[model samples]
Target chain A: AEGEESMAAPADKRPISTIVIIIAMQAEALPLVSKFRLSELPDSVFPKGVPWVRYYGIYKDMNINIIWPGKDTVLGVDSVGTISASLAKGACIGDVFLASDVAFHDRRIPIPVFDLYGVGLRQAFSAPNLSKELNLKVGKLSTGDSLDMCPQDEASLTANDATLKDMEGAAVAYVADLLNVPTIFVKAVTDIVDGEKPTAEEFLQNLAAVTAALDQAVTQVVDFIAGKCLSDL
Target chain B: AEGEESMAAPADKRPISTIVIIIAMQAEALPLVSKFRLSELPDSVFPKGVPWVRYYGIYKDMNINIIWPGKDTVLGVDSVGTISASLAKGACIGDVFLASDVAFHDRRIPIPVFDLYGVGLRQAFSAPNLSKELNLKVGKLSTGDSLDMCPQDEASLTANDATLKDMEGAAVAYVADLLNVPTIFVKAVTDIVDGEKPTAEEFLQNLAAVTAALDQAVTQVVDFIAGKCLSDL
Candidate 1:
């Protein structure tokens, strides 16, 4: 199983000294950025034309990296996966990843997913006790090709017992699979897919309302990162 | 009545040419910040010892300012209001404000509110046709002093036909009331208070999932601002 792969990291490898927070957009990174007062890494530091950009800082004496892939899961498998795999190739056993994003499934319901469900990679690696310790509601998450909050799409996903739907988490997991690292998700419910027909332009309308809550969740995730990975720092 | 106040300003007044995006934390401002690539306003710009801080920039040729009052509506009436009213005293007739935040109302149901509900400000100003054009579900928003997502609290709110609950929107309205400025809420549901004894730590557990949606909603808000206020720009 993928969980065991992380546990069995060879003694000769680096002992996983970093914690990465990957998000789809800058907003998701703000709370952490401000909370840690993170400084933006200069463009000159990265090789030109890289598909992703990151902010680096120290929090609680731990090295924390926050990355935003240029876009969402639309590029997760192809671009994000490749980049993540390369960065994680030499990552140690305790290296942690907390992938965050917005999702839809139930009607006007906000559900937190701690466990990931995908087509393959049943051997997916998850954080040792992040969900259990947080006492959050864990459920199966199905990643789709596009935003799936419409009534018709909701009905289809619900029929299969998939309570959560997203665009990029699975792809991120694919990258984790390639690197044999442990990852967990910290998602917030933005809207319930009732019969309302939402256009791409209207997608983020409710974001302001839910941001206060997202700030709190990200804070918890940071707390968890400090607890589990501070030893490496 | 309030709508008339903002709509009937004298031609010589400041003319309300600015659009302010008010929120509690940096996360809520993420989508808008990145979409506009807003720059932080230095503390020296505002009169010294202000209770809140703001970021300002130009989006689509309109003067856009995003403010975070250090916290939520908990300070809206007292601190946020005094500061906002002072700023709006010279604001123009057509200026717009898009109030954003996470809210909880019914038990386990996240509902969006397009209409502002309070003791009196019934004819309050609204974005010309933004909500109707978008076909969003509009309803009454009841603001309280604390987080109202608790089980017993939710039952009481539903009994009053309150579709949404927030800590800051109504309070922001109080500030708008003082300055006679038009404001609308673009809120998203973050949690359903259905018997889920959510402690302070657990309030934002599901935020990551919903942030993407919130991001989309905020983007739309920015677009609306561009369309409605660009003439002023």
Candidate 2:
């Protein structure tokens, strides 16, 4: 929170009314759904044939909505039209990281102005008090569709000064920023990007345990956020 | 239009009331802004410090909004939270192409099920009558941030069976598909991805001419779409 002053403020700083948790993988979603005792709507709120699932319940005076994009679909930009975290760099598995900012590491638009644009660097809504209370690691999160990083991706990651990498964080940040919604990312590391094990193998081996940790951390974060205004956080 | 039967129907087939044209570059946007006689908004509709520009007007009973992301920003997923054309394969300069489908040429999520999601293959809304009336070529459009293609990108593009390459088309198509907004892409070729000339040089050389062609084609398409239902297209 050293540079909290530079972080963009939410368009609206009113007291928290709703908290939406967006999960791409079903494994990461189910545990939280059960913990919150959310009800799966009998009918999908999405367009017909899209496999996205929604679960909602009231938690501590806030309407909590959890969305799972299902197995077949990746998180599309539109999911935000309706509606992060758990990965890191140089971190041990199960270590929780909160996004101070987010960006894209895979895109490389080399044109003069576009090179900056292609990186899609965005600031996550500041949550300094919550970070201090939870003792969280706060740093930049980089996103791309790919699971493993290549040399070019590595260069971009370094350029982005990324502390965590994931598939969906920046996208969520982008939309949240656009809508002026205050956003915070709580991520539990499952596998280190530059670690010894192959990403896929290590991810599968650690996913369940890490997801539980993420669920716990997110619940704590939510509990702290329930009635407080974003500015207070 | 050969495989039109498989195209997904719009969630709503009502008459078009508003048309949104999202242009990433100012050069590509200005002509259409003039053609439509759109007035630039005096106040920023977006969050402060973001350079996104908006122009609006009414043409032939349809409300038209043109958005330019400005020079410094790439089209973020959020831009769609607010809204295709002109690059092709085997296409001569100034040749207009309509997107039959769109996909990403750069993302490589290697995991099962996720890989399919990574490719993000999405079909553009079918426009058989519009294509027939305009005499425009229709083919799969591929999007990536890079101005130039690498070997891996080429492989992905081939896997996508892409006939056009662009920076922003697939993102736009993805959002439109998710919203069931009935999207169609009309592009004028500035440079061919596989051509002998270096992409940057060719793109810079041809941009003005191609954009003018794009403006004319888009004007005609708008005229054709004015006061018509999505189903009519």
Candidate 3:
């Protein structure tokens, strides 16, 4: 379904010209795309053998990673270790985390999210880019941990004016943001953060198309990024 | 050279016991036997891999696991993920990393490590004989995050004391310990925490005997645990 939507996008409407490397994992990928109401993405979007894959077509152009560091520190850092190696070998880095997922053990831990983005941006800027300096942005991203999106509390949402939610985007943003990279988390409110009635499947169907559209827009921006000259990049 | 040190062991030291299982990866296997320090152990105990080696030797009596996690997280967990899946299967969890390998940038953060012995002890008391509980000790562990150790830096050492000066122990302990299992760490300390002038290769040679002895001791302990029962005859 998402594939059809993306395919139908007019060249002007298609944001392929600026495709940012959407490095995402697990739950983060699902909510982002599901909110766009994108039913499915191109098969080419994901390589075979990913750790988690609950969502569809929105990740079509992003480099979706499967490792989640938050729950399993070792695997999480293992992903980072590989990234570090990539950095050593001269990998270009993004400028922000654009994190949207935030859940605490208590779900009440003060959100140092802004601080997390601040640090990530600092480190990402140093990523092996042709240009030593890149403009970075950190924005509020909405996300939940599970595909069902049934656990989010409404009071939390009402407190923070977030637009969408997923599990993985926040971690992605946290890591990248600390690297001092610019990040923008385009979010969609698929489910009430806290609600008496939560329907994950229904929420997914409701927001899928909008997410695909957002992904399309984000991809164009990233494409613009990839085409920039390193010195002036 | 380390293997050769086993030569000095009394001829009878080599166990008549052996057990082997097919594995898909080497990292998981390395944890069971290779993890010990030779200096602390006696002779004859060792992990034997196959192709040309004697298989049905005295080790037929050995309760060994030639394990393979079977192709990277094929089941709910990758060997590199963390303790969750290992815990779920109720398998012998080895190498629950205390410190992470510098494969990613997120490796630098300090985290708490809880020992399993305490919990193991609790298990033993509850299941008395079915499975004994082990202690869970929480302490700091460190790996060679740097090329050399700063032994002179009292503060750092104090801060990271229980920290495994090497990497693999804590991971093993983390997983095993969490489930109230007894675990041992035999690290080949190529780099001391102290600022040493010794080259890495040179240091390993000096500690070769120690490593060998430690390795031997650990093997015996493993045998003891596996054969906790009295002689049948």
Residue-wise C-alpha lDDT for candidate 1, range A1-233, written one tens digit per residue = 12234555452243444667776645566777788777778863443444466788888766777776543222222222111100102222112233332222221212221111113222333543665565444445544333423343345356535544555566566455445455666555554434243422233564544455555666776676564442232
Show model 2 residue runs off by greater than 4 Å: A1-18, A39-56, A67-89, A126-129, A226-233, B1-20, B37-88, B126-129, B195-201, B224-233
- DockQ, candidate no. 1: 0.01
TM-score of chain B of each: 0.63, 0.87, 0.36
- TM-score-better candidate, 1 vs 2: 2
Best by lDDT: 2
Candidate 1: deviation at residue A221, Å? Answer: 51
State the fnat of model 1: 0.00
Tens digit of per-residue lDDT, candidate 1, span B20-83: 7787545556666777788877753443334456778887777777776543222222222111
TM-score of 2: 0.77
For candidate 2, give the DockQ: 0.29
> Please, what are the lDDT tens digits per residue for candidate 3 over residues A1-233?
01233456443344333223342322344443444334433353323333223232234354322222222332331121111100001112222223233321102211133212211221122223322233323233433222322122233433444333344454555444333334444333333433434433334444444344434444444444443422223
Native-structure RMSD, model 1: 20.3
DockQ of 3: 0.04
Interface RMSD of 2: 5.5
How high is each candidate's interface RMSD, in Å? 21.1, 5.5, 19.5
| Model 3: residues with Cα > 4 Å off, grouped in runs | A1-218, A221-233, B1-63, B66-141, B150-157, B172-182, B188-192, B199-202, B229-233
lDDT of 1 at A143: 49
